[model samples]
Target: MKKVALLVIVTFSVITTYGSIKSYNNLNISSGTMIAILIMIISLSIFLTLIIDRKTLKKRYIEKENELKHLNTELEETNIELESSYKKIEKLNSSILKILELSSFFSAPKLMERDFEKKVLDLALEIIEPAENGAIYLFDENNNAKMVFAKGYDYEKINELNLKKNDLIIPEKAEIIKDIHKINKNKMSPKKFAAFIKLGGNLKETLITPISFNNELFGIITLDIENNSPLKNYEDYHTKIMDYFGKTFAGFLKMLNFIKQEGKFHKDIALTLVKTLEYYDNYTRGHSERVANWASLIAEKMNLDKRKIEQIYWAGILHDIGKIFVPQSILNKAGKLSPEEFEKIKLHPTKGEELLKKVDGMEEISKIIRHHHERYDGKGYPDGLRGKNIPIESRILAVVDSFDAMISERPYKRSLTKDEAIYQLKRMTMKQFDGEVVRTFIDIIDNFNIK
Candidate 1:
């Protein structure tokens, strides 16, 4: 539009100037007057066109330049967003891998505090990379944070500091101190502020994440990075990460508690069952306890692991639970039992196994109870598993069970001395008993002088 207007103005001026010059020459005007009038009209028209064109060009260039600048700014922002998203994805992947590793570690049947703390510290460092120092302060049973593990601190310096429970700062307190320093608040005492600053020690960047289980505060994990490179606008992100970690740790702690509780429950149940059986039979009152004690000793002598020892003890207590099915007449018969009655009595081991198999975590103990009567030479009844085929626990039970039976008075027979029982066990070695188990049992008795 501007170009068209300028073209029209120039054409009109050129025609007017030509007409004026011709009239002046025709009317006999002086040559000087004609020349001056033509020059003035031409110069005035050229000046007006130049002014319009310059203003139009300058306005167009300014508008175009502003559009380009806006586009460049938008492109720069998009690139920044893309870069931020990439970093987040990378952090997410790293977090996932760390969680998997932590899960595997915590899944073990047993977890020691020292080993667990090491794993926690390793994961903390991975999440807060480039940190100069790290510490895991676990809340003790009393709900107080105590530094359980630390990395990148001088042992001598730590000991010299002697930072007791009171001196150690809590998570809330640490956050307050950090907030105060961030805003440069001077209301706090200088001495106290200095001590707080010294605790963190030139590390302006610090992260404190709480470790909690079932809404119970378990501990806190803190990481420190270099001064002046502190994370910006990280409260929300840090909270989310900490919450995830806390929930995971809480799950592991719950599982551990459950395992411990289950173990105690099993022990308590075994003790109660033993007591019930003892109440039913006068001759066997306290008999299960003595057998369990002896069986555990024998197991230890044979170098069995602690879990196996526990199983052996529990099985010993319940080994005779099947005797409940036997008639009192037969069980307490003062005279020798007929062949039929003796055969009926021999079924107790199978009955005991069947009865105990219903209980969870008692399957192994049931198997031991079932095979307790089996002879090492395959002469015993109820499946006659011989020698090593018999579970070691059952073999140990057999030795202890027989020893307790001999030492306890019964309706059919009087009690034997410890020496006599030991002698009888030696005689039955390799036949009614595993020779190794019998040997260990005898050694246990001799060592403990239980007679």
Candidate 2:
């Protein structure tokens, strides 16, 4: 409207300039007023255009600011979600690590023997934090419970614990709480409370978790509520962790028992073979055991690999297993043996290899036994493999075997003193044994003071 008005004013002024200039000059009107009116109309039109432009720019600026704010809000929400997801993933990773660490106890075939119950209790307490003390009770085939271990809590800890069948609270299913005051004194007695009483504390409520297998409860782990217990502010997340323990331990214990049974079977068989030697010659009683111990010391002194050490140890224990095949008369012979008798005795190493080779998983063990009697100079027996050609395990066994034989009293000769035995070992380093192995054995005997 202002532009149109300015146009109209300009048009009027132009017409007046031409039509009224001469008449105004006649009527006394000045040309300056016409120019001044044109300037006012143009200034008003320019000011109105500036006002419209400012409003449009301000509206666009506000719209852009609102859009930026919206984008920022969305980014903030996304950041919050990402942080939450990261925390969840972090927790999941931590849980997985804990499970794997616990599973390692099961993975090791040997570690689960002496400290099995203690390890289980420790892992359980870690998962179920602030626990005071606990006992792990394993049931026998007769469904009888025995407390195998107890640990944690200064006040409630037991240095030595033994739970009879009547003292345990084994359940037919998984459970979480046990009331000691309500338990039958004659059946599920709190016999373990006596140990804590000595520490000026008594038992209260117990959190019990039964380890079940094949629908039968085989074991129970119990955490206590004692004076020093810190389990007051327990959270809801502990349920899943404790449940995992019960189930995992149950499965692991079953497998662990199988390993133990297998190990015990091997020992029982080895002992049976040793007894045969003992029966034939009383001097051979515990000879294999001593040889094994000495071989282990030598292996450690040399810093042998763990697997190699285990192999050497077993080889030394069963080195003379073939003596059973030799005649009793030959083993017990006191005087110088006839050529036939010596030949029969030499067959022991071969007989041992044959006997053990038939068994499963004894391949390396049999090989070590076959070579234990071999000499470093390639003159020993069976294979006559020389120098480093002999297995490292066999070289280790030969040194300890000779050392043990020298120190041991035989029917044919007087036992050499430990010093005399050492001198003989040093004298025959290259001929009878590996020089490095013999040196390591000397260090073992000197450092460990085997006497």
Please tell me which predicted candidate would have the highest TM-score against the true structure: 2
Q: What is the lDDT of residue 32 in candidate 1?
A: 87
TM accuracy, model 2:
0.60
TM per prediction: 0.60, 0.60
Task: Provide the global lDDT of candidate 2 against the true structure.
Answer: 0.73
Residue 143 CA displacement from its true place in model 2, Å: 7.0
Q: Write down the TM-score for model 1.
A: 0.60
Model 1 pairs whose backbones collide: none
Error of 1 at 386 (Å): 2.0
lDDT of each: 0.73, 0.73
Tens digit of per-residue lDDT, candidate 1, span 1-451: 7656766877787688778778776688777876787677677767877888899999999999999999999999999999988887778678767877788878533353446777777786777555567777665665444566778654334434434333444453223124324432253356544654555456565666666666666666767665666553243454456557766876777777777787789778777776776666565677777778889888987889777887888887888888878777787788899999999889999998998898877888999999989899998879978899999998888888888888877767899998999899999999999899888877668655456
* Model 1 stretches astray by more than 4 angstroms: 1-209, 212-217, 222-246
